[model samples]
Target: MPGTERSLTMRFLAEPKDVNFGGKVHGGAAMKWIDLAAYGCAAAWSGKYCITAYVGGMRFVQPVLVGNMVEVEAKVIYTGRTSMHLGIEVRAGDPTSSEKHLTTHCVAIMVAVDDKGKPVPVPEWVPVTENDIFMRDSAIRLMRMREKITEEMSAHLS
Candidate 1:
């Protein structure tokens, strides 16, 4: 996604420590990758430190095995007055076969804050490509879903 407010790519080699008893990478480890990738995107977009405010629609489609190289790609999908949403894709690279497989995907919402931890407005974002448009649209859909879920939960509680 070109002209995105920010983007980041990180790679890690899967190891035994990252795996669970089943020899597959633990869900928590994958989540950690997501968090770091998203945080980096937000910080790059804001040009300052950003804090994660929420996470949504984290789905693990497949398990990554040890000895595979994993790559996480993150990009800013949208920005609000004080927040931004990052879309992340986790891909697994097979060392022996040299094949890459998308294993998981997620969206992370982050808030821009001042030194005192007060929310701050985000700067203008630029979207110059089709990939950027797709990412933005996905973020919009996720935001609407979040709103709908919140409303439903509120109604249920009431």
Candidate 2:
């Protein structure tokens, strides 16, 4: 069902299988969760199948333990004709405690697609509160950076 909601979270308990030889949850595994959460948020808001067009600024602030409780949050901060800009954060804590620490952050650009896998329009999103406003502005900045990089790459190719 389509929703006017702006954010979504997916939670899980990190397992040993998610760990790397260094004894921390693997970065790739965490990124997979981030993509899933972003997809859920985009699909819910657009009411259509969504595809990841770009992922930007992925950074890890801390490591997650194997037994920690993990939460991947995706927020819709901006929307274009067919693209949704999402901010994603990952947090983790001991499974038995409430204390959480930020582990990762990233921005994802997703495009709503139709049956033929072509881009389709996405619902508009407006930031109402101060925090939402900040997030929206950040998303815009990220979008501009992406555009600039693309332009620079094209010029190099030419």
Give the best candidate by TM-score. 2
> How does model 1 score by TM-score?
0.87
What tens-digit string does per-residue lDDT give for candidate 1 at 1-158? 21244779998798899989888999999999999988888887887678999887888898999989899998777888888888889999787666789899988998888899999878756566998888788788878888989988897783
Q: Residue 44 deviation, candidate 2, in Å?
A: 0.7
Cα TM-score per model? 0.87, 0.93
Cα distance off (Å), candidate 2, residue 126? 1.0
What lDDT does candidate 1 reach at residue 157? 86
- In model 2, which residue pairs have backbone atoms overlapping below 3 Å? none
So what's the TM-score on candidate 2? 0.93
Badly placed stretches (over 4 Å) of model 2 are 1-3, 154-158
lDDT of 2 by residue, 52-157 (tens): 9989899999999999999999999899999999999999999898888999999998999999999998888988899988988988887788888998889778
